[model samples]
Target chain A: MAELSKTDQVEDLHLVNLTKRFGEVAAVDDLTLTIPAGSFFALLGASGCGKTTTLRMVAGLEDPTSGSIRIGDKDVTRLRAFKRPVNTVFQSYALFPHLDIFENVAFGLRRRGVKNIKPIVEAMLELVELGHLARRKPTQLSGGQQQRVAVARALINKPDVLLLDEPLGALDLKLRRQMQIELKRIQTEVGTTFVHVTHDQEEAMTMADTIAVMNAGRIEQMGSPAEIYELPRTVFVANFLGQSNLIEGRVSGAGEMLDVAAHERSFRLPRERSSATGASIILGVRPEKMTVLDAPDAARVPEGHNVLSGRVTDVSYTGVSTQYLVQASWGQELVVFEQNLIVGDRCEVGDEVVVHWSPRHSFGLDGNEDIHAGVDSAVLALESVDSAPAAGDGE
Target chain B: MAPVLPSAAVAPPSTVAQRRSRTGYVLLFPGMTWLAVFFAIPFVTLFVTSLQTPVPGKSGRYQLGLEFGNYATALAEYWPAFVRSFAYAGIATLLALIIGYPLAYFIAFRSGRWRGLMLVLVIAPSFASFLLRTYAWKTILADESPVTSFFNALHLLPDGRILNTSIAVIAGLTYNFLPFMVLPLYAALERIDPRLIEAANDLYASPVTAFRKITWPLSMPGVVAGTLLTFIPAAGDYINAELLGSTKDRMVGNAIQTNFIEFRDYPTASALSFALMAAILILVFTYIRRAGTEDLV
Candidate 1:
């Protein structure tokens, strides 16, 4: 399990055991991450997950209590923020009110006393398509224009690392989506290391080459958007990214492969995992993974799979897709999605159907059997328990 | 700029932007008119007065004679006073800047509620009698006072005499105007988005470099405002000189007051006031013009 620690496979900017605390509470704690260069890396998290704190440390706004931050071979732990080869596009865009678009873009270069600034400033502005609006003051510019200027301001400095702190959060949804693509294209063209901080899962999904999902004050998982979406390592990660159904099950049998048991059914799990039998697990699968089968799904499918019958409790049209909320035999509600066409066979509410999905599509926690037993008994006893009160009255 | 109501091109209707602009103009006119009347009229009056002369008479009284002699003589007679005022005010402004900057930076960038409380303290003396504060400093610096006693205990001054000197006048000026210097600087520094300083540091600016490039430049509006405030009042101040100093330390205001109160010479007093006003107009206007607050704001 610890073998990966010995090998250094990541590049971009590596934060080695970074930790920061304000008074007593830890803001960023023992966080180690490697953001590869030429990748639009997003630190995706909820508020207070230490994502912003981590970004700020790299931006040199907050000094880490202990850690070494290296951009390539340069150790920038002790370097002043301005002296570091990184620049930030703040959440508010923070354009200097005094300067016009051109001067605002030229601010960093001028601060360093660059010998020739006009050509580079022009190029950066042109790159952001702001050449026509160069003479306009920040006040006269629209939100999108100002956002581009903020990007141009950071990029004109030719920093080794560019940090974007929710750069598109202020924009409308349509503009934000447009900027996401624009940001990705610009990052690719420049090949500069971009560290973007965002709370929007969709924004990270659309633009990021690598995404680090953070929870509490740590990285829940760091991988590509697809990897995190399809193969979340924790229940928290699975739920945070998108809608997921959690099914409690126990590894009933195991040798070359494992068998997962929930309620009265025994289902074989894929053979990749080496965890022992009778281990408690929480099976996870995306809503799109579950299919509504017309016929009764086979009760005892051969090893390496399973099936369940349920009633479609609800149906919702989401324009591009239709969603079905199905209650399984174990009384667990599972979400399923079907592609919506101009004309197609769509399941109606209250339709009895088989909820089917591959075993490989589901991810399970390694251990803790009590959760499975707790959930199973409570669900199985639900109907009998309700009738017991009536039976007691009759007696 | 979200308009209160959307403007429809095809419909005949009033829009928020149009209504707001109208109301804004209404609100703006009064202050603009007040400035035009008070500030604008006085400067015109002073300029016109500078050209008028004292008609030569045995009674030392005159009619409005259109001659520049009054201005010429006032300048020639009070050249030393003007120079002394300049030197004193210049030194006081420099000292005020040195002292006020750290106070301003602390209040603006460091303190929170304390910033507001501290601001009240800085400007508190102005709410009291200005003459009393100057006179208090005179008493404190006296040979018999506790300050002199402390100096005497230290054996720092042989005679331990601080009253009735140039030092006392400058001290009075600095003490009286320290708040003016701090307030503008505090405002300028406070408004300077802290993110810029952080951005500078992230770009690898050291503490000193950040101050030099970001903090200092950003606070220039305050520096300019403070210099003007300290200098203009200190140059024209007669109370400190009268209360705390002898003949050598008397500034331009003392000379003007002597003409008006002692000599009963209206023409010379008006000429002196007009001369000082002109000099101040030139100096302050030039400085404010160069301060470039338009860009910073």
Candidate 2:
């Protein structure tokens, strides 16, 4: 009878203007985000950057100093953690050392004085692939096994949203990667919204449907992983998500098209607009965008388009690519990512090369577009997740 | 050139440690032997002595003869004392648990520095002498004291006296063992992870349910340790009974003490002591074993 109500559905969670302060410092400042039903979202930031704080606030383990939280339109800001329809898988797993896998998973169920624990606990263990280890105590378990048990325990309650606070933080690197894929797979399979917190950028980017990049207690930017990486909206976001080159320039002319200049050449804007003519501005270029324009095209690179002339100072060989550090006029070195093909002659230690990129690859260094769209809830963005092919995901 | 080169300073430490461990075991055996000889031997001897006959001419003396009849006689002679001791000890332990649990919990879970000061204060009365404190109760409860006048004015006590009663004996015993209860209980409840309480509360259980299911269960070891600490000594407390209780409230310990010292009845004393020890041991063992399953929150 109870199964008819929820219909195997997980509820969406929303944190509205969540601001938590510990004395003078605001751990999470005005964090407003909505997690869609059944999405895996990541709140990523460095230590003390408030990622964990936000997750705790959602779980009702920590009340925000000022904010409102909702689970499927039900206001639950003041609700106690046990009273909320959420559970957490702590970084340490925090599995009861005294309880076996079965008992640990059955904890929430038994506490509610719920009957029929055996079948429910068995199904939970089966879901996490831990049925074989149901009788083993937590102390006897490996870290990964403990993590699975923690997941089993939280999910057995059929919580609305599962908050995973660095659930993979205690694993070895090899285990971490393995769990990342496994976690993503599990999220998708279960269709339960998972709000994961971690300081590891690659982990967040690789797993989350949407990643919220936080800095200094405020969300810098949030978008789908691709949008965060390729279309970061702040200098912080750009720098935080992989690497990028920032160049100071001016919009010399404007129309249906616009022209901008960096150290050595004028380039076109990706989007034409009517604003700030002859005003000082900054330009952004990803490393892969700039390339070595060889003997012929190097001579006459055009304005508002592909063209850069800089001297390559250093080159290092990666397994599949060579990276060249190029010096420009502004006394700043521009990094260029060159394909290291076995058939092609890669640049040696030092060589003068014209690095060229089309305007589409260039963006303003000062990124503030859609900064007011309430930093897309990392949860909803996670709904559209497709991880960049990992070493074995392609297989 | 001022400092000489270190000449293999630690080269033989391993060998030295091995030799020391051998020597350590050799040295440890004697102390253990003495414990076996003195402590263990006497306990066994006393258990043997309990099987004896009462010397008919003496009022409270007996002689050893491996006679099982001494046990029956001892029980008959001191059954009331045995019951009274346990009853008083039970009440004292209950009082100690009720009073000390919160104090220990407050120290372990709530109050920070105050816990330390309170701990010192709890132990302070013990250091001065439990007998003196029992005597102080004598002054407070007697008809001659200011407390008597206060009680008389309040119409609380018709006789205006509380000393030499079962309640006074229990109070004395509780006071004597309060620190024992507080310390071990504090240690046990303190070991509980606070997060567990929060975790339980978060899982839709009320605060009371969380505490009962989680916090209380986890602190079982402490409960056993504290209860044992309080109950064992309170059961054996002869001084409190002698000082604060009349014949009606006298415990098994009083009977044993009177047989050994007042009547010079060594055999009867040993028999009474063994009986008290067996009963206390069983009580303690049962309380602890039951606590194990239920206390681990």
Best model per TM-score: 2
- Candidate number of the best DockQ: 1
Best by lDDT: 1
Give the clash count for each candidate: 12, 13
- Candidate 2 chain A, poorest ten consecutive residues by summed lDDT: A386-395
For model 1, the docking class works out as: acceptable
Model 2 lDDT, full chain set: 0.76
Residue by residue across A1-395, what tens digits does model 1's lDDT show?
A: 12111113224798999999888889888999988876789988766778899988988778999988998888999876767778899988877676688877877877788877787777777788888898988878878888898998887777778899978776765677688889988877777778999777778889998999876567878999998888866666666777677777777554644677777776555656323234677666788876776554445443444577888999999987889899888888888997765386677788778776777786665455332322322233233323322111110
What ranges in model 1 sit over 4 Å off? A1-11, A110-114, A271-278, A294-305, A341-344, A366-395, B1-68, B144-161
What DockQ does each listed candidate score? 0.42, 0.41
